[model samples]
Structure formats: C-alpha cells, structure tokens
Target: MKSSEVTSLSPPPFSQVLSMPTSNQGWPEDFGFQLGGTGPSYILSVEEGSSAHLAGLQAGDQVLEIEGHNVSTLGPQAVIAIAQTQKNIPPSIGVVSRIQQV
Candidate 1:
C-alpha cells in the first residue's frame, strides 16, 4: 500500500488488517486492524465507536504486539492473510465476552 492510501480517519482495505495470532503466547488482550503504509511504524486505526476506539485506542498509538506476535515483522499483508483464515471475524475488531456487564 502507498503512503497516500492510508488515512488516520479511514479504515484501510481488508489487506491491511490482521487477526490476533491463535498461538499460545502472550499476545495483547485486545484486537483491531493495523494500518499499513510507509511511515515510522505500525498503527491501530479503530473504527468510530468500535470496541477498540471506545476502549480508548487512539489513532497514532504504535501497535507493539498482537496475540504475543511481534507485528513489526509480520507487516500488513502477512497479518491480514493470517487473520483471514479465521471464520466470521468482523472488520471492526475481535472480542470474547462471558456475559453482559452490570
């Protein structure tokens, strides 16, 4: 993807998103898409009112890790490919809840 393609306010193409690695490692507890483009590093651009954005994930925070996997090396395409193998995953983010919170 080109640098001009990705904007901080818009969600990139499906090719730019990644799924949380199912590996039994120390991955981050949250989930969302990773913005891909020429820049300093990886970033998480949460959809407006999404679980991630609602949870306080800003547009510029560097994504350190996902499912304990170092995203810095996987890049955008690799991550999106991995995430695609999973079924029924939403474009916004991934989550698992036990029950409704009081």
Candidate 2:
C-alpha cells in the first residue's frame, strides 16, 4: 500500500495493553511514522522515557520480533508474551517495520 494510504493500526487490544509498559514518551511535534512491519507476533509502543524509547522506538514503531522470534503473526497475543517475559529488548528490535515519512 502507498505510505499515505497505510493507516496506522491501533495498538493490540486493551486486554493485552497492560501486559506492555505504560510509560509515555513525551509527545513529539510530530510522532514518527511506522507501517505495521513484520516478524513474530509481538508489537509495542515505546513510552517516552522508558528504556524502549532510548533504544529508538517511536510512537508507532512495530515490535516485529524479539531475538529471532516472529511478531507479526502472533499479533496481540505475542505482544503480551514479550512484555511479560522480556525486559531488555535490543535497540534493533524494531528494524523490521517498514516505517515511512509522515
């Protein structure tokens, strides 16, 4: 899909949201862009000050995988799994997403 046509998908369902962190990175003048990338099933938002943010995730970057695990296929279920089990995701964790200029 064209980048403009690719609407940013909503976060994983609310039930699974709590499993992920709640920290909010400061609001940017314009949030960076992310196009629901691929890999394992887990995807997450990096809170402004949280470690995830420092690693480079913007508001819409998709957590396509952790280590080598696939995240795009598992969807919300996979995200919960990562949030619950992994605490120190690498800075490269979100590279799979096909982010675009906003």
Candidate 3:
C-alpha cells in the first residue's frame, strides 16, 4: 500500500477496542499483529480475533504513533521503546492505513 491515501484510524469499523494487560501468568501474550521493519514500520499481518485485529489494525497499515509519540520524530529505538511501554495498555499506538479507503 502507498502512503498517498493515508488516513487516521479512529472509531474503527468493528468498534472493538483492545489493550495489553500489564501481566498475566498464562495469557499466551498475543497482541495478534506482526509489526515489522525498524523505523517507519508497517503491520506485516494481523492475526484474526487478536488484540491487534480487534483494535482495527491490519496489514499495510502505517504506524504513526505510539502512546502519544510520533514515529517520525522518534528514531526506531525510541519507537520501539514506546511500543514496549504499551505492553500493559490498550490502544498501544495510533496507525495510519490505506485500507480506510476500502
């Protein structure tokens, strides 16, 4: 997907918001989405019914922010750090997607 038609993902189509728990003994820990690349990453894929899937994430979505930090301003390490912090929260990050047009 190209960034030309990028748009913010809000009030997602499914209306199923999700978050990560701080800790769990046997939660299996599946956020359901595979975020690949180092900086300016894209979601390579999203598992069905996973938190990522429920929260409206999908393949080809461009991750725009995490927590509240812009991915562009922060380097890959910083972005990774922000993502790490969200391990215990819901809506871990904000992402832009071309799929919105669909």
Candidate 4:
C-alpha cells in the first residue's frame, strides 16, 4: 500500500485513542507491542496482559498519530523513533482498528 493509503472503506474507519505509559526508556517494546509496515504503520503484535493490550491496541490496527503528531506519512521505523524520543510520560496514540467483515 502507498504511504497515504489506509485499509478501510468509505465513511472513514473506526479510530480510537490509547494512552500508554511507557517504561523509563520510553519505547514501544517496553510497552509489550511491536510495530510493522512502512508508511501508515500497524501493530504487529500485542502481548497479553501488557500495557498495549490493556490500552486496547490490537494486531492489524493502523497507527494514525503518536502524541498528536500525524504519522500516516512516516514508516514504522520513523514512528518508533518518534515514540522513543517523545517527552510525554504517557503518550496518546491514535489508531484505527481494521475489522474484517465476513
């Protein structure tokens, strides 16, 4: 998919904000979740009982923003870098959960 593309239909997608408190290192890995994809990064996995899972982040959920910064044009690595450098104690992440319709 292109950097501007999101896996969704018309009427927009279901988006939510999750406030996740990170460890002293301030890394997503510390929150027990991994990110994947180039631009418009998505959650690769979420560990059970971890902060990410408790925050409602699920695998396949596309990351829309990090700490209010639009990240749809950024790659996964860039997003991770932003997360690591953010000064926010508990960063607010905006994400869109892609629900598969059977």
Best by lDDT: 4
Candidate 2 lDDT over 6-70, as tens digits, reads: 66888676432222333212112112222222443322454564445545666545556555556
lDDT of each: 0.44, 0.42, 0.64, 0.80
Alpha carbon lDDT at 84, candidate 2: 42
Q: What's the best-to-worst order under TM-score? A: 4, 3, 2, 1
In the range 46-72, model 1's lDDT, one tens digit per residue, is 565444555665555554444444554
Which residue pairs collide in model 4, if any?
Answer: none
What lDDT score is found at residue 10 in candidate 1? 67
lDDT, candidate 3, 1-102, per-residue tens: 755876887764865555556643222235666666666777788888787677788897877877666785454455655666554555357777856663
How badly does each model clash, as a count of residue pairs? 2, 13, 1, 0
Candidate 1 lDDT for residue 28: 22
lDDT of 4 by residue, 5-39 (tens): 56965786636554465442656777878888888
How close to the true structure is residue 72 of candidate 3, measured as C-alpha lDDT? Answer: 53
Which pairs of residues collide in candidate 3?
Answer: 19-90
Candidate 3, poorest ten consecutive residues by summed lDDT: 21-30
Give the better candidate number (2 or 3) by TM-score: 3
